[model samples]
Target: MKWGRKSMLVAAAAAMLATAACGSKAGDSGAPANEAGGAAKPGNAILATLGEGNDNLQGKKIALIMQFNEGAFSAQYVAGVKEQVESLGGTLQVQAAGNNLADMASKLDAAVNGGFDGILTDHGTAEALEAGVKKAVDKGIPVVAFDANLNVPGVTVLQQSDEEMSKQLLEKMKEDIGGKGNIVKVWVAGFAPMERRQISYKAFMDANPDIKEIAHFGTADKPALDTQNQMEAILKQYPNEGDISAVWASWDEFAKGATRAIQQAGRNEIKVYGIDMSDEDLQLIQDENSPWVASIAVDPKDIGRVQTRYLYQKLHGDQTDEKVVLEAVMVTRDALPKDKKINTTELGEYIEGWGKSEQGIADWMGRSDK
Candidate 1:
């Protein structure tokens, strides 16, 4: 993690307060420490002091810009951000780029011009946002990026540990397939997180020569339906137990399609391992007949809360790691809730630690202050 404390204006604008932000507290006998002074805490604990007593975040305007506004993941992520920002007494300014690169850039420019105190970019690539992010920084407006593969000098990049997630998913696939069989892969090129995961995929395949790729499927267009149709065709062509060992998908959407195809075709022998998850994913995995056995599930809401907290810290003059990669939890079919009453919005409630972050406490305390 690299830390680049920029202009004086940025430092002046920085602020922080947290009850349970991210990771454990630092500076105790048992807590770890480095030459720099404190060991980083996991989950939402901030061990180091970021210097308190700044103005509360109330009435501060924060802009959250995204490339797309659709999908379950997007909805949950937006919900998380809305909850955090509102709790922290900051007003949220939302912009949807509609998957247009130029529009994304324009929205960033708008946020800066509109004088938002902070900016958050979701799932954007460097090509689509570098200039705009640079502009925001130039204006002394701190910007935070979520899932954007950017190497910008001062922006904070928050993402999941994709390589480790990929490794776990692939290891599970290898176990199910006995380390050797015909496998299908669903992937896309150019997306940053997928690119990192692809590196792991390649390394895994190289180390295990026994696993052979019988077919290559890409999910660039009409993701779920396209993948489902393709998997159905493949299942028809190879209609034998153990003939197709497993299907590996880079994301849960592709995995959902593969699972559907397998279930429809009564291919009970095949299993799927995928990265990422949503409420729909949990529902499917809970099904006894689902081919999607496991996934590297992450709480999108938690991601939003964490990213928002990072912005809150930065706004309060708190020092943070340049890059924060959150670890993922392995979710399996058997571990899913037996009752199907839970709705998508309530999914986070079922998660181990969702809205109960130290950041939430900070927000409430700051608001209640006289």
Candidate 2:
């Protein structure tokens, strides 16, 4: 599912155009006056401008097409989108393609043909989604892509800064391993964010000669199995290589798979690190016998909310920056308070609430511009 070199070029160009055209002044209403002719404060003026725009989606319809809704992460994203769209007075129609590229294309066509006001998709591969995105754009539908590389023209991506996430994960790995280890990196294929993680990880490895990457491969859909298989094979090949200090995964599923393989083999010397703060992964981190030391958490609900706000602004003719990147922080089990425990449901709620907040939306829009 990897994009060919030509497709990559086209995607890059499309992304540049999409980002450049993100801003608009069409939706702005007259600024509110502060007592006759008094100048309005910056914050108040911003709020007034937003207020003047139509936030009601009472009759508007939104379509959300996911790469696949098989995992908790994808489910959380879809839930966030539905909740936010409803809160904004809109209806959300969701479709899952189960990782089938052709199915995604068909679903997107249906959404556009059905007159959905906006489309939200989880990008699986730049090339695979390109045709669908082009169709949506041709039909004047705005697209908000989540958790994938979106270099498509006229598309807005709602996801974390890939480079930043990778940097945080690598820094944490260095901290846990004391900057010395033979690491194996397993990444998600066809996902742009995971690709970026690999790029950043290579940079980190180059900077730290003490750390060596033994193997690097892609785990497209079955990330967990991919991780397990890759790790198992590596372990068998390097059965006596005691210097393997860590296993780095670009996603929690990969980390979990690696953990399972390592545990089965009774290798306690290897530490695991990854991104995506899934609840199950968090529990493992908290487990006394778990090998997971740290992870970078990007709240999917936050991503949904942010994308909604941006689409709202765009729909109403508001100016926005072309690319938005959110920050992620590394979480370590040792950093948790002694009395605190990981709560997956609570974390889900926290992200869900974000999708319902105007402020959250605004903040996300502001960040997206940069």
Candidate 3:
């Protein structure tokens, strides 16, 4: 949890494994032109080649349960999963919960009873689904949690490392704001990863007294709305409080909402920061007129592919550790080379290459063990 040397070493190994496992099959052509940890231009050829060698997944049934089918961001993740599942020769049955815990529990139970070989779940309100997950494990089914958090005992892997991601976001925010500003924090309830992000942000705040959290939007089902309302309320109460300099939401939607409220209030001084590398957020950062500053890019497509690969390996008897945490890279428009703009079109291609490359797949597989 401290992210000490041991943690870094482990994370580094996982990253290596993820990179290596990207392209691992014959005639698989989506391998990125650049090496892992390197940069490459994005293109359609890359998307076409996504998940080439993942055919090893043939003849398997992978049940996917998403928190909600809404949002382009969520849709992309599901698309990524579908692509990987098909490439690996696995069949996918997707069910959406519409952000309802009861629906999620019912669907999860059906997946288990229907004899799904493996299960993929996006982190939601785990408390509501904890019992359901336990029941699945009781039936010898392995579950992979992505983007969200659930403390289910038999979870083959906990997909993302939120603490590290949060730290990266905070560091980027400080750099974007020139290292000193008052910040507001917001998060969603039962979304474990966001909770972890809040913890990391709190740590950063503790170390930097100058950066105080004036208000917090506690976790809720629709955290973006709650966060927006909180920001609006704060701006009204502190009308002239020029000290409020930044708004940090745990997710991009919340950040977007906060930005909207700030703009409506005619406060252009407050910068906005958050996670989830959503296209809208990226465009906002790219816009000269926008107050959006930076974000920690979490490639859901890549996360889906990696999660699938890990599950496949585990099913095939790979000796993986109990947890796999992927580190997210900080992304700012300023960080992009002037010659190389952020290529939204190339994201799928890059991820595809990462998923198909042999070394990339191996590297990602290794991360599970570490």
For each candidate, the alpha-carbon lDDT, in order, equals 0.66, 0.60, 0.58
TM-score of 3: 0.74
Worst 10 residues of 3 by lDDT: 19-28
Rank ordering of all candidates by TM-score, starting from the highest: 1, 2, 3
Error of 2 at 303 (Å): 1.3
Candidate 2: stretches off by over 4 Å: 1-56, 151-153, 338-340, 344-360, 363-370
Candidate 3 per-residue lDDT, tens place, 248-311, comes to 7677767777887887888878888877765556666766556777777556556666676666
Better of 1 and 3 by TM-score: 1
Q: Which 10 consecutive residues of model 2 have the lowest summed lDDT?
A: 19-28
lDDT of 2 by residue, 238-295 (tens): 7864658888877777787788888888786788887776546767777767778787
Q: Per-residue lDDT tens digits of candidate 1, residues 1-370?
A: 0001221222122111000011111111111122111211122322122224544656678888776554455555665666666656676766765555577778788888987899988776787788889988888888888888777777888888888989999998898788899898877654667668879999999999999988766543345666688789889899989889998888776787789999999997899988777667767777877888888855766677678878877687566677988777777665557766453344444555432334323431343210
What is the Cα-based lDDT of residue 301 in candidate 3? Answer: 56
